[model samples]
Target: MSNSPTLGYLIPQFPGQTHIFFWREILALERMGINVALFSTRPPPPGLISHVWSDEAMKRTEYLGNMDPRRAAKATLGVSPALWAKDVLREGRVLAKDLAIASAAAQKLKESCAARGIQHVHAHSCARSALVALLAQQLGGPTYSLTLHGPLSDYGPGQRLKWRHAKFATVITEKLRKELPELLGEDQPEKIFVQPMGVDVNALIRDVPYHPHQSPQQLRIFACGRLNIVKGHQDLMAAIRLLRDKGIDVRLDIAGEDDDGGSGYRKELENRITELDLQDHVALLGAISAEEVRRYLLSAHVFTLASWHEPLGVAYMEAMSCEVPTIGTNAGGVPELIRDGIDGLLVEPKSPDALANAIMLLARNPKDAQRLGQAGRTRIIERFNCEKGAELIAREALDLRVSEEI
Candidate 1:
């Protein structure tokens, strides 16, 4: 334990999903007495060993600040360019922003690691954070690694840059690992590792025996994710409306932030809910903390996420750990976790009718819902606990360093 290596964690921003994953990994490493220091463009909260740079650096490195002008230019370039040009134009805006953030974050990370004697740097995502970690490694000579979460929209132009520069990369699902080599080339395949995003399964698993809601008169259905176009919340809302039209008395609670790529999708969702007269039946509880989210799961009969394309649904795992029946779109890594109709239901992505039908099927059949929830909880305990995930990542981080040295 005393001989374990020290690591520096780098990110463009902290206190979000990336922060959660990085912090959990840090805690896991710390359990073996490995030390971690975090460096970010945005300041981290107290209790995390964080290094914050000046406000000027933040302004220059922010994604929004760097993206707008480039995105506007790309939009003006029109869509008729060559396929490569079109792909570059489409992904260029994000790449520009990530590169800018990484450039600035790298300088800060270099200074921090040099001062702290950190051995390796691991970034939470493969975009800006990975760029920062890579550049910082070049500056400080510490080996760098990255963890890739889903939604490739964030990687854009800088994806290749980060992949080539990182000592190794960890992805949350095998689906992502399969896609990486194609994007980064076969030569870099050895640098990619598949590790699922994990939760504290023991803490989250239902301690007591399964108990159905005493009153079966009212059914509670839950869905969560950033409320946006890709999340298919609009489809879920439409499905809920269809169920209501058919005289199915059900309640839905949707939790998450409303800012999804600035499309005003959240407002549209609210308007549709109003138009359908579902104000009383649907509740929009925006962006609750993870602990609060657990409480919401405990209170609900079923948990659902209808995202059109999810890389790996961590919220689904969290809900499953809480013994709640789950349903998700059959896109991305969702099918990897859910054994359709066994552990939970898997409906066609972006189909409101399919989502509605699935919800109604579970709502009417409480016994099946209970069985699914129990099965899901059991599955999560066996595979996706934080302790197991951390062990794997920590081992990989150390291995990456050793391999680089060799």
Candidate 2:
């Protein structure tokens, strides 16, 4: 391993699920004696991690100056514009806004590298951060790489131009990798890699085995992810109702942020709980820290996520690492991580009955659930450790750089 290769980690916003996952990988890389630098479009939460470096990656970016006129026109046509035209106009403003930010950040990164005699750049997402990384690469001679995660389809068109300029792009699933060539054209097939997101198996494995079914009266079922449409929390709520109606005393603790900012979904979730009379059974704990999540994982009887499509769920891996059995919707790359019947159960997406039945089966059969959870933890320890992921990515990145230089 070369200690001299400077690896710059770049991201747009630095505190969400993506940032937390990347942070774990960064820590892993650093522990492996790699020189790593971190950059963001905006500063991360204070006191989390010391910045190796920071600066505006770009400047003087222009976006829709005034969208009020457009909103007025749309409103006149009987369209209920979600926000003032300004917000709608600013929707994609991140491209230009981030382009400017990345340019400024890249220049500073180049100077930082020159001072440290650094070598390469890596961005966490193929979104705004990658755009910034691309610009930085143009200004500095460092080779650039990127990891592509969610909002997968929406980013393809806009990211095509930027991706073409990258040294290599890593995606979390083979599903996305297979679609990339068709989406971005067949010419760049060799530049893409299907690298699933990884988990810290050692950190996740607790000293005490997770005590399953904590309450004699209540069956504790847990699901976690951002409270968004893609996660299908609404469907999970419906499944909870179905299980309750079957005379099963089940409790669900859903953890994640309502990033939609007090929108109807949050209210709708509350209203659904009221309508189903599930107020006593379900709890929506918004945005708990990672340490708290591990506790929840250790406490719950079974872990579940009924998402419509997941690139590769870090939460699933976390639960698995904690020896908690998982039941997820069979969509996206979920199957890649979960082996149905062996590690965890896989249910049909959007099917509340299927989900509820799976939950009921596991809840009723403690032995089976324990077997699955134990198997999952073993699988995680053997496969999903951060050291393994970092080594694979680092080796591939170094190879790509060397091949390009030749």
Best by lDDT: 2
Query: Per-residue alpha-carbon lDDT of model 2 for 1-406, expressed as tens digits?
Result: 4544657666665644434566678767766666676665564333322222212211211111122443333223432233123332644655445444344455555555557665677777776566555554565546778787864565522466467667777888877777776667743525677676678886787777655553356888888887777898888889999987888788899987555544536677888889888899888877666777887888889999999988779889989989998998899889988999999999999999999999988887888899999999888887777666576557766552322322
* Residue lDDT tens for model 1, 232-264: 887888888888888777788987765433235
Question: Against the unseen true structure, what C-alpha lDDT does each candidate score?
Answer: 0.68, 0.69
TM-score of 1: 0.81
Show the lowest summed lDDT stretch of 10 residues, model 1.
Answer: 45-54
> Which 10 residues in a row give candidate 2 its minimum summed lDDT?
56-65
Residue 237, candidate 1: Cα error in Å is 1.3
